[model samples]
Target: MLRSGISIISVACLLLFAPIAPSLAAIAPPLNLAHSPITQLSVPMALFSFSGSRPNYLGIEDGKLSPCPGTPNCVSSQSDDAEHGIAPLKYNNSPEQAIAELKQIIGNMKGTEIISDRADYLYVEFTSSLMGFVDDVEFYINPEQNVVEVRSASRLGESDMGVNRKRVEAIRAELNKLEAQEAQA
Candidate 1:
């Protein structure tokens, strides 16, 4: 009789507790940053100086870090600006002249297309290699320095994107050199 009574109690206890067991197991461990491993990683900025008598700021093509038109203090960072596809002017050059020069430089390229032309900046589109993958690239040209800067989200990632930006910058640098040579000739 005692054995049967104990069996019934065991079954009752299991039935009562089994429903709560899953909930307890599902509870996530609290985040403890102190115990977690820590280290600092750096993502390289796309650095290029416009070739001129005086090097101008090669402003981030993406809107981030752009100063407000009138409010000097109000500014947004590049990560915030890249997503909206807004290309802010980095230099104080004239956009119309830059567009004219760009037209002259590109010279009937089939895959290239100008997406926006406003003030001193013009945005263009083309297919190019990025992070070892072929990607559609968009960038702005500063007519004063005759420099082009690629603005892509790949620019923000920590992986091979920096190398890819360097590659793009290389192409831009080559083009700038070629244009400078043409201007000299």
Candidate 2:
């Protein structure tokens, strides 16, 4: 009971403070000491951090992304079920250009680290700003379908509050906007 209670409190604190950490730091004026508490809380953050080990089944297998493990914390373009399925990213230009633009879009996002960048495949790790939760996101340029197949999944937990799905959609929106601008140029 005590462990569970602590877990709940930790999650609550993380959720409450994560979004406002930067603001707190800035609130302290020129020195920006808002991050002082963050440093102190690092121990708690590390303790509660549920970042699981990276999955070995990450890359394309047999022409498709690995299926989501019947979990809501994941979304994939190749998923057959609607709950986990998302439309693959479409591209008008060549696959090379498409992936390049994707890298550009993702590179600018907060707390993202590109893990792999091959000619036809890309893998990235995204960390939450406050709680340090990690999510793996992958993209494969499918020339056969003229789309970029994608998979995004949390490293731990069964729910991500639709974050995985929203991220893909957000990236889709950015890609669309970038392509539109490229067309104009």
Candidate 3:
């Protein structure tokens, strides 16, 4: 009888304290610091304070798209060097039609913001989905050359892990497909 009474008291004490344990834990402050373990474990910010400011060389200069910098994070049709050089998008249609198609393709892409749209020039900002990293992309319709000059560059990092190059290629692929469809139609 004595043991049974003691067991009943222990069970009662546990039931009373169980709900309070979580409340006591909740009294502790939540971690909000950048260096907190939660932040460290989560996805990293795309742009850091140490990353350089956004480039001012976006628009047309000397009848050409902006040249890629020495960094490999950039790729440009106007660049003379092979490391940073990517071929311009070739199209057989009028410059107006090409630009319109380019606009449509860019519109379909995710996280794209068209900053400037002109008859022969276009400036777009592509942001990364994970960390909001921004990449500036420019296109110049060169009807004389029958090619759309392109420049893609990361605004933050020294290297973009070929993101700029891949973006340009993706755009090119889409443009080619669109042009082919138009021809078929």
Candidate 4:
């Protein structure tokens, strides 16, 4: 009878713990490609060519950032449609200082390369860490509006899993934090 009772308790314990085990496994870090033979085989095929063939449509046009393409993969502060529209980054400092701060912020982020840095405009390209997908990102300091216009679009894909939009929002959040810190100082 004692052995049967022990078995029952053990079964109950497993039933209680079984659901939590998969969640823990889900949090485990992805395999390192450097050490794994399977990942090494797949890495080369995933590395897409990012030639600079796309024409630069980044600079200020008609005192606004370029509109997002019809695809959902792009987002712009100047876009009129709700799906492609995002709020411009407002600044409390001069446009020059704000642009400088923005450059610094983009410089600190991973997998980004600044292609052009003009007095009133900045252009950057962000590459995905795993798949090597490239996204063109641009910032135009609109002094007249007291805000910095932004545009981010994927180079090749119809859908970017909201990566471009999230990138802009993340930059906006970081810039806001930086501005608050400067104000306190």
Candidate 5:
């Protein structure tokens, strides 16, 4: 009797799951590559362009431009102004105090420049962590409230960039929370 009951349960289980097997097997056919192939492909390797990312160290010799070795697509005859300037955001506080606070938040950093400063926002550019990409950071601060908010957009290669973006966003959220707490204090 127990053997028959086990067999009955097995058959019932198989019957219940049988319908799902066909649905699982009904996957769409593989992409019809032969019917329609994406022949015209354009790869935008802007990172390879010298203007895309400027090196920290530039060497010029004998009326010729020489970038450091291992730099990608370093042009020996290009002007320094190949890229667009990144204007820093402004702050309401005096420039000196704002600069101090900015440096304090981001410590021991190199290759950063203050592009613009106003009463509310401060714009800054810094060499990105990526090998050949620069990121622009915009800081909006309320001096009276002693609050600081920072925004930055990063340029990155195709691999795992989404995860990195999320990490940066998490950092932004934490900073914003800190700013709120400071404002409350």
Candidate 6:
């Protein structure tokens, strides 16, 4: 009885797929290389996009950038845990001047979009060059702390390969360089 039941299922499957086989096979014609120097096609630089939706918990909540989410793909100066803790940026200038310098530095980065820019708060999106994955980075100049609180989090994925941390460091380096240039000038 079991053998007959199995056979019945097998036959049913074959009958269901048999008529569609020819149509599937005819979906594409055989490749033709008869013409030499075939036309070239252009595709966007970042072919695959994985940018997740923007989070609502961005910007300052209580005189600070949002705490890093419970994931390895995030880093925040406001976070206390070692896994997510990063020092806030210190500047010896007015908050407006600090924000202006930050805007210039971040605007020049590739695949970046400045979503929101204010005197003391900025929300920027940084997209990866290859897979087009986006990371949301925020900076809030807390006059009370006299430092810029930062939060960088990947929109999608559990592991960003330390990208968020490295980006913060790079921005810190850039800020330092810019400060030095201004000091000299």
Q: Top TM-score: which candidate number?
A: 2
Least accurate 10 contiguous residues by lDDT in model 5: 68-77
Model 5: per-residue lDDT, tens digit, 1-185? Answer: 23334365765666687668678667746455555556455534321222255333332234222321232212111223332112223344464555565655444454456666655555555553323355545555544454444444443332434432343344445445545666788
- Using lDDT as the measure, what is the rank order of every candidate, best first? 2, 6, 3, 4, 5, 1
**On TM-score, who's better, 1 or 3?**
3
Runs in model 6 lying further than 4 Å from the true structure: 1-45
TM-score ranking of the models: 2, 6, 4, 3, 5, 1
- Among these predicted structures, which one has the highest lDDT? 2
lDDT of 3 by residue, 83-127 (tens): 899999998988898899999999999878898999998899888
State the C-alpha lDDT per candidate.
Answer: 0.40, 0.88, 0.82, 0.81, 0.44, 0.85
TM-score, cand. 4: 0.73
Per-prediction TM-score: 0.32, 0.78, 0.71, 0.73, 0.32, 0.75
Candidate 1 lDDT tens digits, 41-82: 332221121212211332343542233222121212222433
The per-prediction CA RMSD against the true structure, in angstroms, equals: 21.9, 5.0, 16.5, 12.2, 20.4, 13.4
Error of 4 at 38 (Å): 17
Off by over 4 Å in 5: 1-99, 104-107, 143-146, 155-185
By TM-score, how accurate is candidate 5?
A: 0.32
Could you tell me which 10 consecutive residues in candidate 6 have the lowest summed lDDT? 1-10
Model 4 lDDT per residue over 9-62, tens place: 765666687679688678987656777676644334223355345556667778
lDDT of 4 at 49: 52
* lDDT (Cα, 0-100) at 45 in candidate 1: 26
C-alpha-based local distance difference test score of model 4: 0.81
- Predicted candidate 6 versus true structure: per-residue lDDT over 1-185, tens digit per residue: 23334365765666688678788779967767567454354445453578878888787766867777788999999899999999998888899988998998898888889999888899999998656899999999989878999999999989999999999899899999999998999
